[model samples]
Target: MSVNIDLEITVTGPLDAEQAERIADALNDVAQDEGIQHDISFVVDEWEGRIEVVGGTEYPLIITRFGQWQPTFESRVHGAVQAVALAAKADIKWGYPDDED
Candidate 1:
């Protein structure tokens, strides 16, 4: 049996190559610890932003912070999202079985 955790996390706003790599590293590190081999990817946009914490403190208004967990039809997706959500303190948005379209 293969265990893989696939979750969607958004890191928005203008990003340079370095910032993207760091984001990948952090997500990978978390996934590895949970026995999941997966990656975090983002599609950047002008207004989309993610809050960044450097040296563990001080956030730039330019950066935005977000955490979301959506339950899919797949069981594996559920596991991954749940695991990732548990690892963070920020509030997470969980998709509902009856989400308003």
Candidate 2:
């Protein structure tokens, strides 16, 4: 049996455009460093699986993993998200059932 998961990550806290860009950059860098293939995007409008990043920390940025993934792949993504959160100086909250710290 294949172990798969869907991760919805939200990093909360005050953020300007520059900070948001930095977060995205850090995520990409971590993904590259760990050799994890992913498609990550920042949106200003509501997406299918997420809401828009409005002003204030209440509607902060969100990062999500779609489809199925192996446990190892899930671990890599979790690590990468941690790095991104640290670099962005933000708080990470795992959404729904995949909540881990």
Report the number of the highest-TM-score candidate.
2
Worst 10 residues of 1 by lDDT: 55-64
lDDT of 1: 0.33
**What is the TM-score of candidate 1?**
0.33
Off by over 4 Å in 2: 39-101
The sequence of per-residue lDDT tens digits that candidate 2 reaches over residues 8-100 is 434444445555555555555544564442433323323454332321222222333432333444565446445544432332332333344
The superposed Cα distance between candidate 1 and the true structure at residue 45, in angstroms, equals 10
Candidate 1 per-residue lDDT, tens place, 1-101, comes to 21222233443334454554454455445445534333332222233354421211121111112122222222333343344343322222223222233
RMSD to the hidden true structure, all candidates: 13.6, 9.8
Off by over 4 Å in 1: 1-6, 38-101
Best by lDDT: 2
What's the true lDDT of residue 78 in model 2?
Answer: 48
Per-residue error at 34 for model 1, in Å? 2.1
